[model samples]
Target: MTPDLEKELDDFKLSHYENADFDSLTKKTIQLYNKFERLKDKKKQNRVVLDLYTLYLQATEILFINSHALSVTVDRFPSALFIDSFNLRNFISENFAKTTELSSWFFKLIFSVLKDNSGTNEKYNLYTNLIKEVAKDYLGDYDLLNAYKHGYRVKANHSQTTLSISVGNGQHFKLNDSDSTITYFSKETRDGVPIVLQHTLNFKIGRIFGKCLFVCSLLNNMRAIILLHYKKPVSSKDISSFYINDKDEWNSMFGGSHFKQPVFSLKGLNKKNAIPK
Candidate 1:
């Protein structure tokens, strides 16, 4: 690429990194939540909600990175940071991998706790199914995320508005009559081509963003329901234990101020009060 084109590409990529209005709120809300492990004040609880919403916004911001990656690849712009350009795609997929990993873990933790606490009644069963639907709808996304995380081959092949994903792992080989081994490359294929998706980039990215938002909404709804229905008060530790397995990991990523103690809780006091079924 020419120097002017390279500059333009850099400018384009940099644009993706621009801050949103809620970016400051995201940082502030997280800071406030971290400052108080168990927020008793109603105002603080509202801040916690904002923090959760901030997470959804951050996840959505990832789409800009996603869009930038595809644009870079399709344009075939070579960057000093990403000489192959394909690395950008891999990098974006890797982010998705991490998101899915954490989101899945969160959902599992919440559902497991709720399931264990509920009685074997139809109401509880229906609630469980509702949780299942969220997971079911995004099941493929979780699979793709896992594939990317494990170094299983995953790539997006795009031509204009049409995008197809190739997902597979490992290689196959055969020995010829001469005893020479031949290696084969596998792509997630449909009728001998990568799975063709009749969706535009906007659609695919929007779907991903929507799923992320749904998870955030789930977190909000689950907390509210547990507070309203469950007789026992749920502690922040109960919720944090499921997500924060490694202190070192959290400390390195978010600093000691964050995750030093449980930062989430139900919307009321510790007293046990029964909520209607």
Candidate 2:
């Protein structure tokens, strides 16, 4: 074969493998969750948390790229090579906000699938609320992801004492374990007085794993919906055609019966402590 043909074949193989990997995100998340459950060591748990954090970020990016592709007027589905140009936070705020067109279509399809698979409104709402919780967690803890990705600025908080900072004259800011398990600090000035800003975020390992799994499921189902309608000459009125016809497949892949909501917090810095010294 010519060199160009060989290069084409290699690209095809790589693309196929990456697509398969993307589809396996739900399974990979479950495997990590199981591993976390089986491990009892603190260090192991921390390792799992870091892994989950990485997976969560990747999944978020994939979902955003796919969602953006679907939102446009033309038929442009995202491939493995497609990189999202917008920052994750900005993309979510612009496209996934409560009032956005993409948000409406995306959540409608997700809720439809959940309701179909759940078999009852109660379970559907439970899963819906869980997704909402995870999305909120993603938005809030995004900065922590940046800290980890950029300069390795975040660390697991192992200290027994609450971190306190004196803003000069009498006021103080305190951060405890309850506030976050991971912490980072940066200095800034407010009205000529310099103060330390405590950036913190925390998550229960088990819950983070569970939330990641659910998010993967959500993205998987959304992708399925996009493909089902891809390039089809359908109008907005033909919404019924958009539903996933394979209920059993969806039930198996997007099931939320065992999913758990994430309990996490991202506390940036105390504004009250920014007083002039």
Candidate 3:
């Protein structure tokens, strides 16, 4: 990387700081981006460095947005849960190794789905908020996935578009919902079930951006999964505990802030299990 490139990256960092509604950590992410960009230019264009950098920035923005967005999204709901990124990353990496087979598969699926997937022609500015690449499946857990949601929803609803994935090695995984409603009820269903999604690696967006994660969210008998998964895993208990009015956030949650707790299942009954109806 030349001095000019470094200066350009520095300028990019300044712009994100001067422009982005991120946090101190996010500012640090800009620095990380600069470092990674330099490495990417010189280190033979390795994709891992770029992917890690993207996850770092995305997660940072999510942390900031979760704090800020929640305050305004619902006054009654408690402020965003704050935890150090180091600790949070450690938590995710640790838990991921121990997660169930389905969960691990799900995390891999989210990245592959997002990575191999593309097409954002709607009114939503997801293109700017999200980028595509060989989406990495590191940090496979709920927190990182939920963080993606909290951050992206700060502006748009991704559920506005349906999740299309090739599950179980081209088994065609479909998130059971119409396009518009998925993102609308994101927070509620992201974790209602036992499955979780991890981190994603995407095409370089010049360095300063966030990663996307996923979870399951539901609405009025509608069961759907929200991906671009994030950190900040919200339990059914936590979301359930929050008191919501008759009105839900039109741009966010559907049914008041309060939600129902559903039993999580790591095992499932596949078709034709010899059960006669």
**TM-scores for candidates 1 onward, in order:** 0.25, 0.56, 0.24
lDDT of 1 by residue, 101-179 (tens): 4334334534554434533344333333333433333322323333334332333321123223344765434211110
Clashes of 3: 31
For residue 273, give model 1's deviation from the true position in Å: 41
Determine which window of 10 residues in candidate 3 has minimal summed lDDT: 215-224
- Please list the residue runs of candidate 1 whose C-alpha ends up more than 4 Å from where it truly belongs after superposition: 1-3, 14-26, 35-38, 43-47, 63-71, 74-277
Deviation of model 2 at 226, angstroms: 3.4
Location of the lowest summed lDDT over 10 successive residues in candidate 2: 255-264
State residue 247's C-alpha deviation in candidate 3, in Å.
39
Q: Rank the candidates by TM-score, best first.
A: 2, 1, 3
Q: All models: lDDT?
A: 0.35, 0.53, 0.31
lDDT of predicted model 1: 0.35
* TM-score (C-alpha) between model 3 and the true structure: 0.24
Candidates sorted by lDDT, best first:
2, 1, 3
